[model samples]
Target: MSGLGQSGVTAVKWSAVSTLARFVLQLVAQIILARTLGPEIFGIFAIGMVVLTFATFFSGFGFSWSLLQRPTLCDEDVRFAWTWQLVVGLITMLGVYLLAPALSAYFREPRAQSVIEWLSIACLLSAAAAPSTYLLQRDLNFRAGGLIQVGSYMAGYVTVGVPMAILGWGATSLVAAWLVQAAVALVASYVVKPHAVRPLFWYADAASAVGTGRAVFLTNIVNWMLNNLDRVMIGRLLNAQALGLYNVAYNLAAMPNNLLLGALQPAFLAAGARLQGELDRLGRAYFQMLATIFVLVFPVFVFLALESNDLVHLLYGSKWSDAGSVLCILFLIMPAYVIWGLSTPVLWNTGRKYYESVLQLPILAIGALGFYFFAHQGLQAAATVAALVLVLRAVVVGTTAFRALKLSWIELLPDVGRGMILSALCAISVKAGQAAVSDYEMPLLSLAASTLTALGVLTLLLVIRPQILGVQSATMVIRFFPGMAQLLSRANPSTQRGPITNPVSEQRL
Candidate 1:
């Protein structure tokens, strides 16, 4: 047992499996829903999601997360958090129900009234499940948590949502799936870790949680604005159809980032918290994670950006052609968005929660103000503004996190530079591969060729000099594969290296 009763590798493995499974479910669901429903329907649901996601920010007032952050916790704190969040959940549900009409009008989507009202059910369900789920996370029990999560999603989307869409349930299919997923999660999370479900009376028992919860809650609210302001503005300023297109593009761009971060964040937090006093170890682990993620995922987004039009056409059919440009713009910023997300756990576990929260305020302001100005121009302009916000946010939060951690970005540059160089190389490979297959006049085959070409080039480069991606990060990954470490060692020439190129020190992890 490393920290929180599980090794980071094991926790990451389980979480990745769960995240990948859920992504497959979601991707399938999205394909079905997008094909069956009109853009207007998605536009309405997107607006509703905007409201639901906002309420979610303050639903438990971040108390569940406080469970993870607090230096000490008691059963009383768990009970209090559960009791508090349930109450807020009910209140939030009712509030959204009542405000649905007004919110729909503000967004200029009249049908969103019913959509928002129906989706409100998830608010209570999510809140009810928060504490139990957090407890699982705080313990780093990703195995049980992963199973419960993926199983719930499978039940909700596969059993309920997909079949209903096939039956032509329109936007209601989405709302039904949303509620079912939340309800399933609520029941399963509690069952897996049945904490004190007793109601609370004495608020004073939660003094320790309250302090951290307050900061996280406030930060999440600002963070929510940073994430959702573009959607809000796009819906309000543009027509529902336009909003629909942008929503599709935005979610598609965000999917991999969410999946990647969702899998690793818990492990990072638990591991970093345990290693907090060991700054050198913590710094090395953090850099390794960053480099590993960048090398693996950054090129993926680049490939998506380059192939956006064909990807949209293939996945969403020709009707969503307009979304391709939007996807291209949004995908370009994924690296920055992911970098920003990865910084969150580092900041929180290091007890710099307030500093991180403060970082979001101006970013939110800039995004909001920028969107207001640019949204009128078109969806393209709004996406550009959104992209700028992500890059700026990564710079801002990343700098602060580095300062707080007393780490030097200069040390990580060699690895990042190599990843960037590889990305450019893969970009050229994509063009060459696409050209090679274009003669066949098959879009699907062309895409496959491009993807294979890029990945193949990347794999060969890393094999030749895995240290260029940081031996630490590279080693962390291939440790999972038996004998693969020895294979890489044999492929690369032995060198007396300075940190970035040292195969010898890679054994430390």
Candidate 2:
């Protein structure tokens, strides 16, 4: 590997570990919050997040992009970015507070108004946290950033969610959990990057930062709309009960894709940042990434697609059986979504944010119209529309990457072909297991047996075709485990994490 690739890999290793830990914590938190508060409360928290999401999205004003894209940004630039985030943070909080009643009125849920206003505090805290967090990303200090994430997530889960659950707050417990995590992140930022927190009144850098960040911000907005527009539409057209079930199914369907994509996107961006001027190298890197991500994604979707009913019953309980069909259909699109995840960072890092943003408009329009026409048909209709929309979105962006990288459809098809073959194998194996155990009457045991059978089949396939596992070996991920440290150290001298020094800024994380 080149020095840039090596460093990028190490950063990714740390970031992935951190992200995995956070995902685990979040999963546990959501699981606990789900059972304790149930769908009604969980949905409330989801709506609040959606509302606050818009507020915080604008609050960044593209400051992080300025840091990530600018190779020569200085300490003064860092201070300026930090100041901009702080001011925006305060403004976001005020705006959220003022707009809370309007949001409640629109949703026609009076109880949500207070929840929205109280949760607005998190937007301010998040705003304060953004620039410090960006500095960590810019300086490749993912270990620190990861630690903050782990700490904040754990704090929210334990201190807020658990206690509130005990206190019988139900759905309100989610807001409480969010508030605690935001607070923890706010505090940790100051501790991790103290030097970047220099005081400044509103300065002359806003125009410069916003000008650079506008493209990124616009892209993010489009992505947000594409992602949540369906849910927003569902809530408006259908009742909360239907929306709640859809949310559950949608969450489960998206989980595997989100987990892999979450790890891949940041790493992709970091890798792209290092290889900024070399589109050829960037294209190759992304292709390899697409292969790796889909390798894991394929079996996951297949397993979930075949056993959506059993899995939902096992995890979220039998109350969510209505979501099974939704899960199955959404599962069909998981592989395409995973490929999109890998392709997108290349677009972002290659300064194709405007193009990416434009692509999303058509995808969003298709999704919105599809949902409108089909959503009332049934959960199946919504899921089918969603699956088709994903394929369309992936093709639009994938073709864009192909042309921009001077590649052909042939180059992309091989990886996708392999992914399809793997997914088919996995689905057939899982379905065969389901059929074999169909006579069983115990829900828990049937789920356990089906899951075990599917896993065994997947493991056997990895043994038979090692390349199908994505990594070189089944144990490759074990390198991050403390138990394998000695082995990893002996095999690769350069595998050890090293300190990075930023020449342009003295900010520490």
Candidate 3:
């Protein structure tokens, strides 16, 4: 309806396309690597990545969001941000390199030292690209950004990761892919926003950027700690094999969140930032995003939880069967994860990041203690604890977000909750169908049949009670596409006579 709305929609579309492509490619690579290198090797790589993720967060210094959220930016601001990023990146690289031996000793995995060292290069490459990429997002130019991300991931995984895995590189393949992906992203960012590379900095600009980014930086630190605490404890308390199993399960369960909702986060933040002062519009947009994300992601997690055994068998084969149980446990947290994902952008864009960080401290402490205590029992126990903690965290964050937006759960929860109910029903029907077809000879065929039965049940339910999934609101979503409204009207003549309205606006009023 407006330029900002149109740009946001276009950005989300491209982001979805990019995320889907990358998800497929990464999934294929993951299967090949899992089959060839096995879980122990992946465990080692996962440890390195855990360390690298912390390093990458430090290197970023939250400056990207600082730049994006700034009402205005000058050349000096861009240069200062880039300079600081590079400084942080180099420091992080050296820090990881020097700490490698001690980290390896702590993890009790000797190979992790090498993996950590190799992956440090990605931090530097990311820093080099930060300014240009921030500018891209600040301008809402997600098409170019999405293309760059997809192309980099595809080229890296296909050309490097798969071949390295075939050549018995094991964890090295993942590190190689990381380096290639980061390098490509850096190059592409510079290519897209050449002016962002200019090197002129001022002290005042640097100080201003840091001041603006302090809250976000602290929030990210807390988030990283909260997210990785379970993994860290698992790697320490359990063997590489266990950690590997848990890692695979976690990733599998998180796949939908990473690929679908993750794709929309930047767009949400950018759009929210633009509408920050407009409470009514921002509230409506936030609810719509939450509802849409819930409807799309709820069934995915439910299905994954229901058929984790079959899905794991189909994807990673019988060797990873243990991961299936872990996957189910992790899936229990997906609804909370989805809510947190949707709400964080609103908090950050509305300058409530500091408050969120403060609120999260107690939750993080409790969760970390929970993980530490349960990790000794086994991976499944740890996962259960983590899931419970995540649900708590979600409740805290969701409540705070609602209060900040001056909105009530009554306005937001009905649509999203209905979708969850529908998803639960689908899961139940699928479980029943699986039992009915228990004698199916082939696992893959059984899985296919079960999935189809779930979809069929969901379709029937939607047709019978379209409001269960908020069909009116879902139909309005189609308006994001050009001429889609008219096309739908042509197909169903009753649609042509009524004007389209924003569902969240109606509900909010």
User: Cα deviation in Å at residue 382, candidate 2?
Assistant: 2.3
Best by lDDT: 1
Global local distance difference test of model 3: 0.78
Candidate 3, residues 451-503, lDDT tens digits: the string is 88888988777555554545334554564654445433332334558534444
lDDT of each residue in 140-252, candidate 1, tens digit only = 78898988888888888889988998898878888998898889898999888899989984567567677877888888888888889988999998978988999988888
* Candidate 1 clash figure, as a count: 0
The RMSD (Cα, Å) of candidate 1 is 3.0
Instruction: Order the numbered candidates by TM-score, best leading.
Output: 1, 3, 2
Tens-place lDDT per residue, model 2, 1-509, is 12135456567777877888887777676666666666666666667777887777777767766877676777777777777777877888899899998887776666777888988888778877777777777777778888898899899887778788878987677787889898899789778876566765446665666677788678778878877777776666665667777787787777667776765676667657767688766766665555545555566777778777777777777667787788888887887887777778777667677888888797888788888888878768877887887788788898788777787877555556666777777777666667776787555676667677778876777555544443212123332344543433332334446222122112111
Clash totals in order: 0, 0, 0
TM-score of each: 0.93, 0.87, 0.93
* Alpha carbon lDDT of each predicted model: 0.80, 0.71, 0.78
